[model samples]
Target: MKLKIIAPIAAACLAAVPGAVAQADNTNFISRPLSLLDCLNIALRHNASILEAQRDLKASQGIVIQTRAVALPQLSVNGQYKDTERTAIESFGPPASSGGPAFSISPPVQNWNGDVQLVQAIYSGGRLAAAWQAAGVTRKQAAAQYDTAVAGALLDTRLAYYDVLLANQQITVQEASVTLLQKELEDQQNRYQAGTVPHFNVLRAEVALANEQPALIQARNNFRIAKNNLANLLGYNLPRDIWEDVPLNLSGSLDDRPCPVNLPDAIRQALAHRTELTALRETERLRQLNVVNARSGYKPDVSVFAGYGWKNSQFVDPGDLAYTLHGWNAGAQVSWDIFDGWLTRGKVVQAQALYKKSQISLADEARQIELQVRTAYSQFVEAGEVLDSQKKVQEEAEEALREAEARATAGTGTQLDVL
Candidate 1:
């Protein structure tokens, strides 16, 4: 019988050895307590998802720069060196009078050319402007996505933190239950020795204490698991023992404060403040700009270009190089894609279709947000009511336990009553 009880107890203690060792190994680190905001900050800085979102936002900004650069003046310098075999050039124009021989000339054997060219887009039929604006909108969308990531991380941290707190409270309640059961067992054993209660009473008390022990053990394990989960959300590695030893000191209870926002107000706030909605709006605007840019393909684009260059047979010109064998040219160009198998028309149609899709998506997202807000508000209210009723139940249970103990001490109650 002794081995039967001791075996399970021993197994439970052994199962808890790793956590105890972890706590002992980092006693000093475990002494500090983390607040909810501290966990949020840590997650924002180190969480992999949040970091990925930040990187995407940076890439979008780079794209904006790339698109805007198309409208700016472009300048380039180029140089060429050529080594050629000499060749004779002949010209005959109706046997130039005497017709002695056809005129012949030998060209230079080596040549060099260098030029600096500048091109400025005087007009692009709004293509460049629309593209740049679309890029800007995309950047804003990325920013909104990043905000959404942060908000999600914050919410996860809050939930995990509260979970750990809730687990701790449960452990406390289980431990208290175990303590009361032990005391009642002691009283029943004393009464059995005095012949006031039968041996059955002692056996019943022992069974209740045994049951409470396992419950308390399970609660402690759950508390450890909850803490580990919270640590993960705060970007700590569980295997590395970074937060394995840290004791969480949550300051408040789960339902300590009532939610002040009502259903309608909550929905209104979510619609106005939600980053998902903001991102969808920006995406819609970007798609609208894309339609404008596609239509721009039908219009003519105007641009001007100028180049200054020096070309000579020798690498260095010795006499009046600026005036001799130097060239400068400037010209303006106009280009219009009159037809391309209806390609521009196809592109405009595609963009318009995507724009319409985004409009529908935006409306759907707003509905989802409203649903989430209402569901959360209702749950919050229900939880508060449940907590109040549970508190009352707890008080009544405590009073009943007190009265049972008093009756037992006065020899007016049976051991079954206390149990």
Candidate 2:
């Protein structure tokens, strides 16, 4: 029996063995005949999914900036120009002899106005503060998600690399078997020709070799497909419509390693370090902030604004309708939804429900992760036992083959056993 493993050999049981696939530097990207570490490095650098996750994390930072801006001072500059033919100047007097007729006093006069305003939030009943904190938590969630994406990419690269190795080994073993069968077939033919063995012996040997051809052909095709899979995981930028071998050769081999870490320690590590749990913890914090934000609606919102503004009427010269005016203004704002038709209450209730749900989800996820760690360790143990048995079985098979050959040569056994 053959054991085919990929990611778990390194990902789950890392540092448990003295030396295996875990000793190389994955950060070196320029080397040829890529090892597992090299493949992992390339996958992390070029994988589309990982890149997308990083972009998402950057976008979350923007969200954090926007939310925090709500609590900080805002400065703005504005300008406006207007020309109007109609005015109250006609009503100012029955007729204007100040210059010419009323028509001369007002004829599409130009006016300019400008303002520089500063607005600062004095209070928000905790709304702005909670929102800002929630945004920060959202960024944390994005960071955790990015970590998860990286971990997943590394695992996929490992699986693809292992697939290529497994298929290659299968082909090598099958070819060897075919060679031995071919020799047995030739010997059978020679013995039959000399009238020393029956024709049945020749046919049996031929059948045995023929049976291996289909499997051998399949193994070769599988090797090619596995290479393609590995190349895809490595994110090769190949031309469209071309099916080819991997650009880089693989230099790493799967060596059997020992598992020394116990199940309890594995579970503890998974709990402390799993990105999914970290992301969920961030979600729980975000939900708590949402509750605070909702409760803010019960209190009045307050802010203050100050501005320097210029209006045409302040220094308007009716003679030419030219204006050059500037002034300062300041005011405080207060808005209270003392009776909002129960809207605030409903919002608070909804936020509370969601926060409670997040708590339950976090707890459930922790349990599931613990169970997963236990299961994985148990499987690893079982696989080790099976591998030990396979070694013993191989030794027994080799000894049996030698005995059969000796017996056949001594004329105490049929050629069938050797074949």
Candidate number of the best TM-score: 2
Q: Which runs of model 2 end up more than 4 angstroms from their true locations?
A: 1-31, 87-90, 93-108, 239-244, 314-316, 319-321
Candidate 2 TM-score, C-alpha based: 0.85
Highest lDDT scorer: 2
Residues 38-107, model 2: lDDT tens digits: 6776678777778888898888889888878878899999999876565533423335756766643343
Q: Please, what are the lDDT tens digits per residue for candidate 1 over residues 163-232?
A: 7878888999999988888998898888889998889988999999998898888888888887877666
**Model 1 TM-score, 2 decimals:** 0.80
Candidate models: Cα lDDT each: 0.72, 0.76
